[model samples]
Target: MIITDTHTHLYSNEFDEDRNEMIQRAIDAGVSRFFIPAIDSAYTHSMYDLEKAYPNTIFLMMGLHPTHVKDNYLEELQHVETELSKRKFYAIGEIGIDLYWDKTHLPEQQDSFRKQIQLAKQYKLPIVIHCREAFDEIFEILEEEKSPDLFGIFHCFTGNYEQALQAISYNMKLGIGGVVTFKNGKIDQFLNQIDLKHIVLETDSPYLAPIPLRGKRNESSYILNVVDKLSEIYNLSNEEIASITTENSKVVFGI
Candidate 1:
């Protein structure tokens, strides 16, 4: 029952009122490991604070999110590089192309994505990609950067069977989260076709909450709902889903 939430923003201001209590709720529900993804330098201090508070359970990733690629992107990437040089991080990510919000920064996003991928290889760390309406763009960069060292999880994967296979070819494990529980969330249709080893569980908390909790704020504790849905999808018990996904996460994060 040691569930691992491979992606969650427990440091978000959304939890400012009861951060500790909310985390404890998730802990009580068996989500003991929380992998925190960085949006930019602004949240870096808060991420450190979170790690200090829960040293054992909190793991962090450093990167510049695609949407954050603005005029000051180089400076932000410098911050990412500086942080990586200073300490240990499980991965370099929550990074990749995000064309959903606006395509204005597409070129910059591509540059940032390429640079970050190189950084990941340099550090020998896995990458947790955040792709939205940009699979072809993400895959293009990944194709060019393909190597033995280019490996990680595809956070909040929402692609088709063919795309899943493509991502797997690049040595990525699909990060399944609350989206899998949605009625129209198509990944579940062919998820069983993909082996369990290629899957990892996540919540992307305060973002994509699963069914029954949809339209509401998500937390790590709500990951149990995702586990229950996965249990039905794979015809495995909840414990099996938790154990297997957590193990898969360790395979990527090496934690």
Candidate 2:
């Protein structure tokens, strides 16, 4: 059973001490593919180092995260463009509007989101979105940018059935993560209603750890907890769930 973690920060400092061990742990747990999301220029080198370390397992995306859309966002976007020109990237993502932290940068966040969407279209790459407390806002831009070329995954999706439909309408596969295993995470309630094809697995590790390990730092290995939960929700075996979601991930990432 080859599982795919479509979104994870394997390069995050959280795993600095046992990075290799943690990754190997996940690999042993059947997670062979790890799609790494870009935060900002600050972590670019670490991301590259991670790719070099696990060239086959680590896939990279380049973009400025919404939360990191500060004053110098233009320069960061330039860096994204430069990197895209230099080499191949699976996607342009972990980008979108994040109003939970601070609404002061909403305008800049929206602008950055739209610009990055454009960049994704230009490069013919799927986008990985990082939306928080801004589903309406994110959907607004997605509506304006809707096109055959505008497609991606809604990373860490935490919206309702209606919003899920809206995201699907825009060619986005909902990224299911540890939240699906939480007792009150809510997405689990209607997940089966959305076909398995519209779903992909993620851990967002070092964050949103599934129950049994909830409130603690998460790792990709814990994604099995998520797969087990999804098994119950979709009424499929764990291997089937993993196989379908990993295949769905390939559809979105084109890997």
Candidate 3:
């Protein structure tokens, strides 16, 4: 019953007080694998230290998040490239256009997204995307960069059925999480029609907590809530959902 949380921020300051306890809670809940996404150079040390603390359970990814993509983005990308040269990273991640917060950086966000995709291909690593309010914009770039080697997860995917099929066309798997448990989170409506192979579980924790805990801080242990919802949606047992999604994660992340 090993489960994988393909995206989470255990390194986040929000968890500073009970990080270890929270991780233990998740482990107890059958979440053995936790893939950590990087925000920027600032969190690099914390991410490495977290991996060191839970070497086997915790995995690390490096990228400049779109919301963080500002005037100094070039220097940030340099840090990502330099880190890749220094050691192994599971992916170049949490990268893509974010028009929700501020559209002013849309152009720079697109440029950064493309450059990072190139970096991912160069390193033969998967990418974890963070897209918000820019589906058309993000898909536009993905269309241009589509290739046999360009592949990754559409993290925290909250798009339509057509978008799901479209993302798969580009070799990406949908990262399902807390949203699936929300009563109005529409993906649950058509999810059963989609293949489980195209899906993976995430919490995006300290964020989108599943209902029963929505609007509250989320943790990987709560990932079980997501699994339960998915089980109901796909008409399978929790173990069946967990095993398949964990396997799907391995296929995407190569872990």
Candidate 4:
């Protein structure tokens, strides 16, 4: 069975020591495809290096993360445009409003999110959103940018059923990650109500590790844990979860 990790920062410094080993572990665990999202210009080199090292397994996206939006955001968006002009990327993402860390940059974050959505439309590419404590704000921009061209995944989705339906209306698939494995992760309560076609698996590795490994650094190999939990929640087999979610990921990433 082939599992697709639709949103992983495999190129992040968190895996600097044994990145190859970590990737191999995921491969052994049936995770054969990884979609890497860009945070900013700073991570471009490492992301490129990762793609070079695993040409067959890793795909990359370019954009400024919502948390990275700052006073110099215009320059950063320019950098994103420059990078997009140079080569192809799977999507324009890991971008959206993140109010959990700091709300001071709300205006800039909203602007950046809208601009990146425009970029995604320009390139006919999908997006991977990183929303936290700002669903209302994110939805506002998505509402304005809503179109057949503006479509992607709501990465690490942890919202209520209403929000899930709203995101789906905007042509987004909910990205399910390690959180679902948590005993108290609320998404589990209603995830079964959402069809498998609208769901995709992810680890959000080096962060948000699932139960048993909760609070520990996560890796793509641990995606199996998420898949197992999903099986229990949906009352489906692991293979079925893997198959359906992988297909759902392909629809988003166009892989």
Highest-lDDT candidate: 1
Off by over 4 Å in 4: none
Per residue, candidate 3 scores C-alpha lDDT tens digits across 170-193 of 999999999998888899989998
Residue 208's C-alpha lDDT in candidate 4? 94
Error of 2 at 121 (Å): 0.6
- Candidate 3's TM-score reads 0.99
* Candidate 4 per-residue lDDT over residues 142-176, each given as its tens digit: 98999888889999999999999999999999999
- Candidate 1 residue spans exceeding 4 A from truth: none
> Model 2 reaches what TM-score against the true structure?
0.99
Model 3 clashing residue pairs (backbone): none
Model 2: per-residue Cα lDDT over 41-116, one tens digit each: 9999999999999999999999999999999999999999999999999999889999888999999999999999
User: Candidate 3 — what's its lDDT?
Assistant: 0.94
TM-score of each: 0.99, 0.99, 0.99, 0.99
Error of 4 at 79 (Å): 0.8
Q: Can you list the residue pairs that collide in candidate 1?
A: none
